[model samples]
Target: MLPTVRHLLSQPDLDLRLLTPATTLPERALEQSVEWVHSSDLSDPTPFLSPGQVLLTTGTQFDTEAHGDELYTAYVARLRQRGIAALGFGTEVIRDGTPDGLVDACLADGLPLFEVPYRTPFIAVVRSAADMVAEERYARHTWALSAQRAISLAALRPDGLSATLSELSHQLHHWVALFDASGTLDRVFPRDAFAGAGLPGTSFETVQREAGRLLGRGQRASATVLAGGETLTLQTLGRRDQLRGVLALGGVRELDAASQDVVTSVIALAGLALEQNHALAGARGHLRAGLLHALLGGSRDLAETISTEMWGPLPSAPVQLVVTDAPAGRLDAIIEFLELRVEEQPDRLFFATQNDRVVLILDRTGRLLLEDLCRTFGLHAGLSDQTDYRDLPRALAQAEQACERSKEGEAGVVEFDDISRQGVLAFLARTDAREVGRATLLPLINHDELNGSELLKTVQVWLQHNGAFDAAGRVLGVHRHTVRSRIELAETLLGRDLGTFHARADVWAALLATASVPG
Candidate 1:
């Protein structure tokens, strides 16, 4: 450990005496580390003094009345602001003792002050402090080297990146968390530490947002978020302009050089690990595509063979199928999300893209698991009842129909077993539906488009509520008067009385027909 103010005062050979009593100086201030001892006669020595320094000076310029006591007080205040450990006033300069004004100022400021006898040269003290600092630095360097080796070896273990993170957290005495490219938490050391803490609550969102901005600007970036008075640093992973993830660390103070070295090593190891995982995922994607082609091409034997070889055997006889039609422009993100889930249960879960839809086949019990994943991504999906391996073709068709129906309502999910026979009308092809929809409701749609109106919505709501204006208004969260006016406008544009049975049925079908249109 580096020497402190109290340690220097206790050196009997140097004959140092404390001008400020022990009670006046805080225990923490006495134990504060002193990295170096500096001697100066300049009026403003703050410019030359570094933090954690013990400043030694004589009363050469202080033995006067013209400069005033406030001037000397301000000098001590400046040193304190610069983080000087303590002030040592040498005796036998122009005066045989320390100046009364300086002593009073030091005491008033609560700064640690001591008297250095004339026989003890300032050079001697400087040498002692420098040696102590050197020794501490050497110790830190050795520890850092040993930690780096341990972390590197852990990176090579079966647990790989997880082991590296565990070692890093242990060495640094801080919380560590890693997130993937999707901003999803991948690993955290001391796992339960963030359960009730806000370190990764809102701080994670800020980190991801910062990472996006940094990637756009082609610069490396770090964000410091304070959580419960602890500082959390979020650093971008991967090279500039190609961020792969984010790494976060929480600590009470800034990290020392040794701890920082461990962080850098972890970053490098994580980058390499991420690259390896990416390559492996690509290879697996190719294999999955091949297996999917085999299944769809009606080669059951080969499909079963490949699946059995790569993954475990298919569930005995009864497996469920799930088909998804993601929100526009979010298919890639949804796929990434689902892939991560699949990786968690490689034997029990399998998914691949067929045509424009994502198809998943898992054990019967895992059907609900697929539903949860789709709901998490806000995706529209259709699930089929359990069926044997030979019936996949029919099961897939049912799942596709169910998925198409899912787009008609707010639930964003549908099971073949849940839909009524009449709801089958929702499975009409988009081309045929659009043609009929345009022929029946094109006038109203065009009118609404041109006038920026909610006439169409009013008509749909009115039909949904069995043509009751008050009921529809309540559902629309509007007054009946507004609903009546919009319905009247829609009737005029369509040239039909929506109150009639045939007109009501036709308009309802047309509204359902156009419900699948992309916004």
Candidate 2:
């Protein structure tokens, strides 16, 4: 321990009289050698002492009566130029007091003045300075040890959580945990220290409260554990964004100042490492999503990647197609979660998230998985007819149509045939171009005003039977001649012949269009 100047002057029994009480002393640092002895005897003492050295003085070298002011002025100038550490004047030889001019000079030069009492020994002052240095070293060493232990509390082995947490618990001598944002333990130390702490396995929302706590006033607080018979101090181990975790340390040493810094570094490192791993995995998932999109976007076959990999074979696949996205913003987590669920289900051939929802081609023998999926995902699904792998596009279209129909009115999953009203009622819903082509034959539909005109009814019957006059007469409850006359009247009204199949088709189509229009 090197002695400081002020500490050296505070010793007992040196008989050093107080000299310059008002002189400004220069700053003093520790001296490694006894080289300060040479400067003690010089007339202009400061020129011999190194800059920053503490220069203690006695007035023995100067002839005060004849040369006092000149010698004093020279000494002050040299002290100022050399930057001596607070020139101390022992008054024993200089008339028991520092000269006023020297005091004023020291003050103007901005140096510090100390008055050493007659009872203090300069040697005793040296020993005291040495003691202070030793104490400071001890304090720094203690702080460093605490820092090491704090870091160890958050470290782990590559094996997994149990080993890491157990070691941390032992190091901190308290239970420690790395919880997801949900306050559910992602990992815990001491194996059994955390029994059922409600760590969420699949969602971070549950731990958001804990995360918020760590971010706000921080997790540092005193915990009274009656069962364990120990009081623990909790410290948040990271900044708001980095590795966020609650650190539990036993015995209330309070993690010291150095430990906090160490914990900050450790948490930052953990956050970085975890994020890097997540980013890499996300990149892989992105590649897979891109590959799926390319397959679904074009005419390319997905045979080599789809059933061949995710599913063993595509037999009797109980497939469902879905199409919905959150209206608020783009769907991200929900989409990924649903896709994961497809793989986890009991029997799924494979799942593809194209057109917003998963199109699950499942093993028909295991149809129960579908119900479970719908319940879990809370999404509407369009179950399609189990078809061959090559026919997936057709099945997909049917499922999409069903979903569209659901949007039309149902507000739930749709079936392919549920919206297929066009089969039996095709003519009722004909498009405008077909309806316009039949406009010329509308006159036959309105000819019932003619006398004894079974003509309109006959035309209707003939059109209904596809121009079969015998069937038309049977349907009309009349003879073939009556049916023929009606057809002739219909032809006359329209100024056209209705004897042929082509003319019959035109009249029938017109009657269909007239029936479909709003009355």
CA-only RMSD, every prediction: 7.2, 17.6
Candidate 2: worst-modelled 10 consecutive residues by lDDT: 30-39
Q: After superposition, how far is residue 502 of candidate 1 from its true place, in Å?
A: 14
Write down the TM-score for model 1: 0.77
Write candidate 1's Cα lDDT for 473-496 as tens digits. 998899999999888888888888
What does the lDDT come to for candidate 1? 0.76
- Backbone steric clashes in candidate 1, count: 0
For model 2, residues 269-300, the per-residue Cα lDDT tens digits are 55554455446545645554554455355423
The number of clashing residue pairs in each candidate reads: 0, 24
Q: After superposition, how far is residue 108 of candidate 2 from its true place, in Å?
A: 56
Error of 2 at 400 (Å): 3.0
In candidate 1, position 36 carries an lDDT of 86
TM-score per model over all chains = 0.77, 0.36
Task: Compare the candidates by TM-score and give the number of the best one.
Answer: 1
- Please give the lDDT score for candidate 2: 0.51
